[model samples]
Target: MRIRATVVAAVSGALALSALAAPAAQASDDAVSRADIAKVREAAHAASSSKAAFSARAAAYDEPYALNVTFSNFKIAKAVKVGTTNRVTAKVTYTLTHGTDVDITAFDFLTDPFLYKGSFAAPQNVLIGDDFGHCKSTSATKATCSGTIDIRPRDYELLNADAGTWKAGAWAIAFNGEDPGADDFDMGKVGYAEKGGLATTLVQRYSKLTVNASPEPVKKGKTITVTGKLTRANWEAFRYAGYTNQSVKLQFRKKNSNTYTTIKTVKTNSTGNLKTTVKASVDGYYRYNFEGTTTTPAVKAAGDFVDVK
Candidate 1:
């Protein structure tokens, strides 16, 4: 998630003053003085400088705090269809062993596609936790967190440009003592831990199927020609295109029946066109069903009614 400039400035200003004060012996004593607010302008300037430096060197810096934090039991949906709503969840169990007594205050789970190349863009914020929901400590050194990430249609827009595997990781901010003041915080106090072997792939496609049976109301035992076409989203052209050489099923449902039975299976031609013939027997509905591929979602066309004479 992208942080708003104003929010970042506010947080940076608060943390900068905290950086100037002496380390509190106890978390309860970590209060800020009025003098600290007086230096707000100075703190803000310093914060901007620090941000600039961090951005310039962030790619090369391997966050040290990650070494002390570990994540496990991570899980998420293996696949999601394009243009659909989906939810992803993960269980994060972390141990803060860097210090004998570390107090965590805030944290968030993030997913970044490998395409980011260490850039700030493309990292989707998953779940955020404070002393509230989705995060709880079992012991001074151990904590467990779990939460669901709702993916909406707008969120899928992120994949409109790129699609592939993405990695999940945790970013946490911890204080040395409970109730620590602002000055007690620093970039060094944050941690980022990525779990290996936990990745999800995204495919950029959707499918469409259609069907029609000709010679309606024909004599019984007469041949009925069924034709249809299959198409899928073309990411490059931003349009739907024929999906050739794919297997599709021709199904029929009697007028009074709710279930559809497969009449025959046929493969698409070079232009994704479907052509088949079946003997007219009774009043029924005909449709085409595409089972779908790894890159596309399954689809069934609306039933076309056929009258029997």
Candidate 2:
């Protein structure tokens, strides 16, 4: 919807892993941004042996020396379900392990967490926070950090393709004394660290279900037809579409009962429509239920009341 989620925003508190927001290149994706920043780092090095202009892209670039740092306890919600035209935000947390020499307390020091699908070296799709993770020192070299991953799906965007398992990774940068937006920057003095595939998470498309039963008041020996449809969020078209071939359960609850019992299991037709017949035995309510899969969440339709004579 809005520019792809990869064009990350600078974090707040002057400590957001996004602290660097200067001269940002609105590239198509992160790989391009990385290459551009690497090139800039090179040119800046040649122009001035020790200093270079500030660039956000440097976090992904490998430098001659890296600070002694590692990440642990990386955690994100196991499931991120999103629908078309709505905003979803995932909270992220991790432990930053660094050498005593590294001062994560300094505002210039920043860190961030991200998610990607496919190879980490060159992810097919990425989700990054616009803000940096806020940190609190837990020990001399250990700090607890937290941030958010924001996704707003709207309009035709190549998002449906991103559904499924996504891996988590992160990067950190210490500006040292140089500001990311300043003209006089020293890349040689900045500290950088990055790691991929630290953890795994699942993202799924939102789902919806509905049900209806005919002959609200029927003779006890008569037959009644129950029907329903299964649909899921369509991020590309920003509308709901049928989810075909899914197994759905037809459930019933007596008029005075508190629980529903599955009566039969039926598969969605070509268009995700469900139809089945059951004998009218007593007054009760009927509904359709779908047990979710990896790419879709489970859903249950509201019960349709049936009054049997």
lDDT per residue (tens digit) for residues 32-113 in model 2: 2332333333333333334453233443333323656799899998899989876788999998999988998775666778
| Candidate 1 local lDDT, 201-254, one digit each (tens) | 344366788888988877779999999999876544556678899999999999
Superposition TM-score, candidate 1 onto the true structure: 0.56
Q: Which pairs, if any, clash in model 1?
A: 18-183, 19-183
RMSD of each: 10.6, 7.4
Top TM-score model: 2
**Clashes by residue pair, model 2:** 11-132, 16-132, 17-132
Per-candidate TM vs. native? 0.56, 0.80
Which candidate has the top score in lDDT? 2
